[model samples]
Target chain A: MLELLIVSTLNGVLFGMLLFLMASGLTLIFSMMGVLNFAHASFYMLGAFFGFQISRWVGFWPALVVGPVLVGAIGAVVERFGLRNVHRHGHVPELLFTFGLAFVIEEVVQMIWGKSPVDFRVPEVLDFPAFTIFATNYPAYKLFMLLISIGIFVALFAVLTKTRIGLIVQASLTHPNMVAHLGHNVPLVFMLVFGLGSALAAIAGVIAGPALVTQSNMAALLGPILFVVVVVGGLGSLSGAFVASLLIGLLQTFAVSVNVSLADVFAVFGFTPGPDSMLDDLWRVTVAQIAPILPYLLLVLVLILKPSGLMGTRET
Target chain B: MKTTYVRGLAVAAALSLCSAASAQESIKIGYVDPLSGGGASIGEIGLKTFQFIAELQNAKGGVLGKKIEFVPYDNKLNPQESIVQVQKAIDAGIRIITQGNGSGAAAAITEFVAKYNERNPGKEVIYLNYAAVDPVLTNDKCNYWHFRWDANSEIKMEAITSYMKANASIKKVYLINQDYSFGQSVRADAKKMVSAKRPDVQIVGDELHPLMKITDFAPYIAKIKASGADSVITGNWGQDFALLLKAAADAGLQANWYTFYAGGAGGPTAIKQTGLNHRVFQISEGFANIPHAPAQEFEKALRAKYNVGLFYPRAVNQFGMLFAAMEQTKSADPKKIAAALEGMKFNVFSGGEGFMRKDDHQFFQPMYISSFGERGSGEPLDEEGTGWGWKLVGKIDTGSTMVSTTCKMQRPN
Candidate 1:
């Protein structure tokens, strides 16, 4: 039982951190753009597919560099053409536009890749056990993923706080008109930020692809979870997104690792098991069976607990 | 006399006019699948089978002299995602759509089809369900436009339940399934079968595991151990199966020890993980090992065409059925094809008498049960010749495995 907790928590933390990589970009975009990008995780998926394809021909390290660059360029184009055009119709239109783009991108991906799970292997150089707990070896690649995520976070923090461009961009999110008056090339900055956010998402996808099972539909799965993370962390709050990302990651991770039920809790309270009961299934419950519902449950709980989310000024 | 002659000539010209029929344009078939999402592996196999059929048809110059193109939409196995794809297929002028794999997605599409039919009386988009196993699709809630190609719940479970009664000694039974339409049907059918045939087998415990994201199973394993059932039966697929099996193994749930899992893992993913030839007891479909010319030929061509063990030959179910239908009809006309497919005993060049029961259009065929061996405990299932883990356990006939549901709906022969 102790082994289950330690392993599940550790793995959960790792998984959560990977999710943070994707969620961070989404949060960043929301903070800067003042509108939610529903397609954010799709970019992450694109990153994984791109990384897989490039690595297939060029190798892993090259994909690390090339995948993000390509995806970022595409993101820039999408913002300039797709989002900018739809922006005129209002926020609703903008949201719908990105949503439509997500579906179209999925089809395009199928057409190009031929609908199969690609083999996104961890680079041979980094292939080793990070450490083993309870005779189960933790892969080195996962540890590397943790390191990369932390490194990105540090870099993001340094840029956002320490640089003049970063300061201007941060100011523009709140005072865009003023920033434009100050001759800061605000539109160009927005385009660049959106591009960079997408690139970050892609980079996360590339790194996490091998570990998380690199199938094309992986994007759709991540999209909702990332949305939950953003919403739970507070919309447009980067720090909030970060916390929520980890929280969700750990919540599901730990949820599936241990077994707890109403019946078990009831048993402690002197409730005897009934032979014919809907809760009979509950009596035989385990953490794994309930894992799929944890995110939704968390979403509901967070909504009830903090309507404005963990750190947001906005409530919807 | 001259005026009469001219009037007669005009009447003859009018009477001799041709029917003025138009040339047949290519039939655009839309397919919404999880080509890139969690179900991409499945979509991949389905795609390959589709491509083989497409190529073969094109080589022979298409059906009814019109080409068939499958316009694929990647719905990623999400219901909402499929809604968009289905609409897109409609917008793109596709009159026929085929989908399956995600029951929620299928449910959503079926509902849409029901509304669409009511709105448009003259034209209806035909829905072909290949892999979605929800019983609701065929029930009273069924849509006029939808038809499933796979076995329904009662039929599929009856196959397993009847087999267990006749062969296995294990009197005890436990039920485990995912919490979904397909899972519910599996359990419902299991309950029906056990009560009717093996009443002596005590029903110990039944459980529902969630879909997709189950990563651990120790607690469930402990509970199952306590259930004291001699056999366990389940209907689970995707990552759930992989995780469950691994978890069961970790918790020392030995093979065929306390469980007989029907559906899913004994499928494509299972075949890919290990060679079926090498396990102590293996469950597989009839297509994988039947030594027929067509089966052998398909195996040879498929193996030579792609990476070994990337996909299983069972993917050919759709193509096999489709080709047989086309051959009988020799046309892309829906009415003719539907008439031909109903009550059709089509020989899928692979093996087994693949039957398209006139009732619900579900194909009932015999499946295989094999005994797989390995080098030792924990070794992968072998796939080399007879040495591979899987052995022939004889065929389960369509008559014994699944009864035709044509009686439920009367479509005239």
Candidate 2:
């Protein structure tokens, strides 16, 4: 039991870190722009593909640095030309624009890379076991992911709280007109924030691509979960996003590891289902069986119970 | 003036005759499958394979002296989209429709074709399936208009179980599959057959995950590791299969995998990355390494032309049988071709004879259990740029893999 707990907890933290890398960017963009960048995960996919291509040419380390920069540059261009143009139409248009951009980016990715998963692999340097617990080997790549995520969090927090640009950006989030009146380039700050957020998503993608399967549909696969993290954590709260990411990651991991079934629950209540019972499926349900949907269940409950989210300042 | 009028009339008559001749010389076959979205990796290769085969057949004077024209319609891997595409194909005067990437899409097309044929007798169309392997497509839900070339999931599992029974080292097994009709059937069949054949083997875990939705399989792999399973049986294809194997690799889980499609589009790369060294196995109708000279020559030619491996030999077999039926009947009519294909026996290029059972319209042939390993001296093929080739480990004869089907067909007189 202790071994399982240790392994599950480690797995949860590792997965949660990756989720935070994605959700932090999303929540930051929401907090600043008040528009959900639906194409955030798509940018992550672009990062992986770009990284894969660059890794083939230059190697993994260089690709890791170059891939996210290229993606961020593309994000900046989109902000300068595309999103800025759509901004005047209000939040709905911006949301719809990003939504459509996600589809376009996916189709374009397919056109260039085809529909198959790329052969993105962990570097040989990080391929061995970091440690072993309870006869299971903990991969070095997973630990690397944890460290990278932690580093990004520290960097982001330090930048947002300590720097002059961060101060202006934070001010604009709450007082856009006031910042503009202070003779600061508010639009430029918004563009910079969007670009950085997108770059953060790209970094997550470049790192997670090999760990997860890097395919064209990868954005579609991880996009919803990132949204859930942002919403459950509170739309604009980075700390809330952080807590929610770990909560979901651990909750799902532990749930999948435990093999308890509804039948066990029924037995605890002194009830036994007959062979002809209509509730046979319910009786047969296991915690592991429903682990995938636990995050969504939490999302629904949070929406119903706390409309502003756990740490959200915004009223929905 | 008289001579000028005579010359004009002669030219007009000749032009009409030429147009009629060209129209009668071409036969259209609609290729409906996913050309976009998640299933496109497999479907694009399938479409290209059909196109390449059609071009080759046409170059050799076509089928029954009519040029084989493959009309591709993108279904996007959706059932509703497939049905709409079939209707569009029919409207364009296509009488033969072929599709087989997703079993769900194939099932929808099969049922739609059957009902359409029943409603409109003379304008009937035949559905040729080359990859979808749901047993119910041939068993309970079988239709007269549908003919499946690929071995169903049950037949493939039979071959796998027989191989497992021979290997005594495999004591504890786990089954993980996507939660869908084809996946469920594979899980059910694996459990039943493994239990029946090797009663001593214990099933450590049975897991069903959402199809194509899992981004992280580490948790699932953790559970499998905890179970102390020595072997895994999975029916997952596409990304699900690839990602599951990736998770296993990341966790350093050492277990032999007997899979339905570990040779799928991205699967070989994942297997190679795992560096398992022949521990991964797949059961299929044919592999790229099958030692048949003509088959090798054809595969080589296809690779030279398309830069893709012949992943599904069943597509080649289906086209071959279709051409043979057309030649036997000397007609492109759907009814005559269906009648000719029923109970048809033909020598396959891969060293055996395949039989099309009349009752269920299911094709049965020899299936092989192959393992991924270092390429031997004479082996000329590999998948996904992986130097490791699939080596044949065991074979199940056509007769042994046959299962009794409960299909009750209503044929058009």
Q: Which prediction has the highest lDDT against the true structure? A: 2
Give TM-scores for every candidate, taking all chains together and pairing residue i with residue i: 0.69, 0.92
Q: Give the DockQ (C-alpha) for candidate 1.
A: 0.26
Ten-residue region with minimum lDDT total, candidate 2 chain B: B34-43
What tens digits encode model 2's per-residue C-alpha lDDT throughout A128-177? 88998877788898899899999999999888899997799899888999
Per-prediction DockQ: 0.26, 0.54
Error of 2 at A305 (Å): 0.8
CA lDDT of every candidate: 0.68, 0.88
lDDT of 1 by residue, A80-190 (tens): 888878877888988888888888887787678765666676799876666766554455776798889889888887898899988997898878899999988887888
Off by over 4 Å in 2: A1-4, B1-25, B375-380
- TM-score of structure candidate 2: 0.92
